[model samples]
Target chain A: MRFFINRDRFVHDVQNVTKAVSSRTTIPILTGIKIVADHSGITLTGSDSDISIETFIPKEEEGSEIVRIEEKGSIVLQARFFAEIVKKLPGQDIEIIVQDQFATTIRSGSSVFNLNGLDPEEYPRLPQVKEDLLFRLPQDMLKNLIRQTVFAVSTQETRPVLTGVNLETEEDELNCTATDSHRLAMRKATIERNNESLSFNNVVIPGKSLNELSKILDDSSERVDIVVTENQVLFKMKNILFFSRLLEGKYPVTKGMIPTQSKTAFKLKAKPFLHTLERALLLSREGKNNVINLKTLEGGQIEITSISPEVGKVTEHIDSIDFEGEDMRISFNGKNVIDALKVVDSEEIHITFTGAMSPFVIRPTDHDHYLHLFSPVRTY
Target chain B: MRFFINRDRFVHDVQNVTKAVSSRTTIPILTGIKIVADHSGITLTGSDSDISIETFIPKEEEGSEIVRIEEKGSIVLQARFFAEIVKKLPGQDIEIIVQDQFATTIRSGSSVFNLNGLDPEEYPRLPQVKEDLLFRLPQDMLKNLIRQTVFAVSTQETRPVLTGVNLETEEDELNCTATDSHRLAMRKATIERNNESLSFNNVVIPGKSLNELSKILDDSSERVDIVVTENQVLFKMKNILFFSRLLEGKYPVTKGMIPTQSKTAFKLKAKPFLHTLERALLLSREGKNNVINLKTLEGGQIEITSISPEVGKVTEHIDSIDFEGEDMRISFNGKNVIDALKVVDSEEIHITFTGAMSPFVIRPTDHDHYLHLFSPVRTY
Candidate 1:
């Protein structure tokens, strides 16, 4: 392969593809990035058998020449060294030439590097999916959906299915849910589908794959197409395609875990409550259980306290914006509550509790589209 | 101790003292910060037995009340939690009260924390050094002097004396040197002495202690008083006094290692040469030895190359502004050269070599304040 391309754009595309490359992969060839240069453009692919990311740079962009191709061929270079070298290359344009025995020469300015390249044929092929079952959503909305639910996924391998986020689509609404059996986070957004009758409820994607995809997608409102198949899902943006394997086994039904009734309810500013919980967690975190107690008092006031026997105790008081129902006390993992409050977009937050020992619900007061549920700890 | 002090200033002083506190210390009391509030002001001290840092906040500074002392007492609180709490406290001023049984209450805004405190009497006492042998130098100059020599200290414990920087004073100049048997760095600066006859030839301060002291001193031209004694060295700043235990033993003689003559010499821009070596090191770093070769060519040109048998090769070419003597080839550790180049303040760097097997020297072209010497590796 022989081509000269713009250095900045090439670096950007390489970084996106390398997100799927893992240094711990057992397959030796998986540690290399596959690059192909054709008449139209150049394509870079990286995969670890579980997640694959491929990005393409065309010969011309916006009436400006981005790449000048001298020959059409393919080569795979070691990802770690190649990425670092290209990022620090000293010229505006980079030229690559492949010689006999797959010895590639990279030249930019006064520096020249010769790297041993592996055969591109040894790289794994990405899964193919038909575009028949496709849906579109704004890039910003998809990023938010991933961020709101991915942190709640179980990190343990004993329940492998719970390590992925469950995506369910009915009509035009898409609901995403993740749970580690201790806390559950659910977010819903309206998506545009090619077929109104298309629906799926068992698509569980690894939370790690969603996190990588979120990093690559910008916060623009441009639409991105997603296609779902029996065992794989593909997210296609401008000139990039991301593929992830679907987890095996059925996801547990979590609708019943959310509380529908409340013995006590209160509304408070999200930011102040988040700060209070953060301070309380500093002490409770030293206790190893991250437990903090909350008690509602007269005159719409709430007291939050945490105690670590060996360290010290922290007490915080915040006045509620509104209060109703019976006064009650409950204890919970402050870290979980802090996570949910950070993603809440509204100014005010509403919390509902059935009792001191049961699960409770926390939601943005201005919207019913997203909510978080937590299982209270028995600290009495 | 009961006092309400400016939260920002309190946080700053706590952070400075906590640098001397380590969690892995064998003594439990050493993990806590000792605070003594007298009629004048409050003093915070932290010690790990080897190094102690104490900072004072008076009742008034520059016509402003910084501390209000309601009572006189002393107590010690856990360094880790106290530092974190004071940094995130939500009020303009923080009130600390030591109750009966050493139970302390810290209040700011609506947040209150009751921490378990230890008796201040158990904290280690700082060494008392007479100020007869005192010298003063600009804080910026001392900071630079430490940075230029500390990185060359030996990290291995086989030779405990080599792990410290040797400081010697004669006349009005202070000379500092550090070496790890392979490379040596020396820096010198002029100081204002209280007694012109006061001099020391064997003051070895631990590299780790100098590194910590460097972080606390800002880059200002204000004067800082330094006093050296038999077993301790004290640095007294405006309201901060830092004491470090000196390392015992005789330092190695390193003056004869730097060559006084040369067979080949060259001068080049410091930044560009640094960039070239950095790029060459990228390939050599993979070989684990960090060895790169430099060969002089005709027309005042130089070639730099590094080869890793299993990976690849990198070749860089540059034109020196000045070249003299015979053409020669030498191989040295690229990382060591890069470190010296980064700290060279002069725009042009001058290098001299006696031969391929002997040690070479690198110095700033503008002055003789600092110089670095490196031993060559036999590659042929």
Candidate 2:
């Protein structure tokens, strides 16, 4: 393979693909990135069994030449070394030439690096999914959807299915939910369905895959086409295709866990409340669960406090708007609440409590599209 | 004790002192910062036995009030927690009050923290060094001297003395040197001696202490009075006093190791050569010592290459200025050369090599105040 490409564009594409490459993969060849140069452009692929990312750079972009192809061929190079070299290579243009025994020489300016390349034929092929688009959404909206629910996914592997976000469709709205049993985050987005009658409810995408995809997704409002098959899902962006294997288990039903009634409810400014909880957490963080206590005060006031037996205590008070129903006290893991509040985009957050020991709900006061549920800790 | 202090200035003072406090210290009280409030000012001190940092905030500075002291007393609080709380506390002024049994209350805005404090009497006292100033140098120059030599200090504990930088005084020049046996970095600065005949040849300061001190030093050219005692060194800055325990041992003689005669010599732009070596190191870093080869080519040119038998090779070429010796080939650790080049203030750096098997010297082409020496690797 012999081709010369723009250094900046090549570096960008290589970084995107490298997100899927694992340096400690059991399959040694999977540690390399597969590169193919053809008449149209060059393609780079990286996979680690669970996730595969492929990015393509065309020969010409916007009437400007990006890649000049001298020969059509393929080779796999160690992803870590290749990525580092590509980032640090000098000059505006980089030339790569493959010789006998799959040895490749990369040249730019006054620097040349010869790397031992693996035979592309030995690399595993990416799963082929039907290009039937399941749904479409703006890149920024998809990123928001991922950010709102991904952090709630269980990091523990005890329940492997909970380690992924569950995506289900009902009519024109798609509901994404993630929970580790202690807390649940749910987001609803209106998506354009390719087929009105087509729907899938059991798709569970690994939280890690979504996190990586979020990092690579652009902030632009460009449309992203998503396709899901029996065991895999594909997110197709401009010239990048991200494939992730579905978690092989049924996701637990979480709809019944969200409280529908409240014994007490109050509205508070989200940012101020977040800050108060953060300060309280400074003392509670020494404890394993970071537990903090919240109590309703007279005249629409609330007090938050945390204590580490040996360290000391922190107490903060914040004003609540439209507090109603009953005065109550509750304890919870402050970190989980902090996470939910960080992703909340509303100026005012509405919180409701069924009882001191029951699950609570926090949702943006201005919208009904999203809500977070937390199981309160029983404190003596 | 009770006081109301400006938040920003208090936070800065607390952060400076906390640098000397370690949470894992065997002496429990050493993990806390001792705070003493007098009629004139409030002083904060932290010590890990080897190093101590104390900062003072006067009741009034210029014409503005920085601290309003209600009573004079002292207490010790956990440094990590106190620093963190002081940083995040809201409000322009923070109010601190001490109650019975050393319990303390800190209030800012609507936030209040009750912390358990230790008796200030239990905190170790700083060494009482003679107040006679040993010498004076600009703070910025001292920072530069530390940066130039500290990186070369031996990290291995087998030779405890090598873990510190040796500072020797001769006339008005203070020579600082550090070596890890493989490479040596030396820097010299002219200082105003407080005593004409006072000199110390065996003064060694721990590299770790220098690193911490460097972080606290400002970039201003303001003169800093340095006092050296039998077992301690004190650096008196504007409102901060940094004390470090001198390493107890004789430093190895390194002056004679710098080769004065050379078989080959050349001058190269420091930045460009640094970049070239960085690129070369990218390939050689996988090897134990990151060894890279340099060979003089015809027409005042040099080629740098590195190979990892299993991986491939990288070759870069650069033109040398005033190349004045026979063609020669040598191999050295690229990382060491890169470190030395990073600290060179001059545009051009002169390098001299006696033979492939002997040590070489690298110094700024403009001045003789600083030089770096490295032992070449033996390669077949």
lDDT of 2 by residue, B312-358 (tens): 99999999999998999999989999989998999999999999999
What fraction of the native interface does candidate 2 get right in terms of contacts? 0.79
lDDT by residue for model 2 (A1-380), tens: 89999999999999999999999899999999999999999999999989999999999999999999999999999999999999988789999999999999999998999999999999999999997657999999999999999999999999999999999999899999999999999999999988887688989999999999999987899999999899999999999999999999999999989988889999999998998888899899987769999999999899999998888999988899999999999999999999999999999999999999999999999999899999999877
lDDT of 1 by residue, B1-380 (tens): 79999999999999999999999999999999999999999999998988899999999999999999999999999999999999988889999999888999999998999999998888888999999889999999999999999999999999999999999996899999999888999999999999888899879999999999999999999999999999899999999999999999998877777788899999988988898888888889998999999999899899989988776998889888779899999999999999888888899989999999999999998899999999998887
Report the C-alpha lDDT of model 1 over A1-380, residue by residue, as the tens digit: 89999999999999989999999999999999999999999999999889999999999999999999999999999998888888888889999999888899999988999999999988888998899979999999999999999999999999999999999986789999999988999999999999887899989999999999999999999999999998999999999999999999999998878888888998989998998898888899998999999999899899999999998999989999779889899999999999889988999989999999999999998988899999999975
With candidate 1 superimposed using the best TM-score fit, by how many Å does residue A193's alpha carbon deviate from the native? Answer: 1.1
Query: In model 1, which regions exceed 4 Å deviation?
Result: none
**Candidate 1 pairs with clashing backbones:** none
- Give the Å error, residue A13, model 1: 1.3
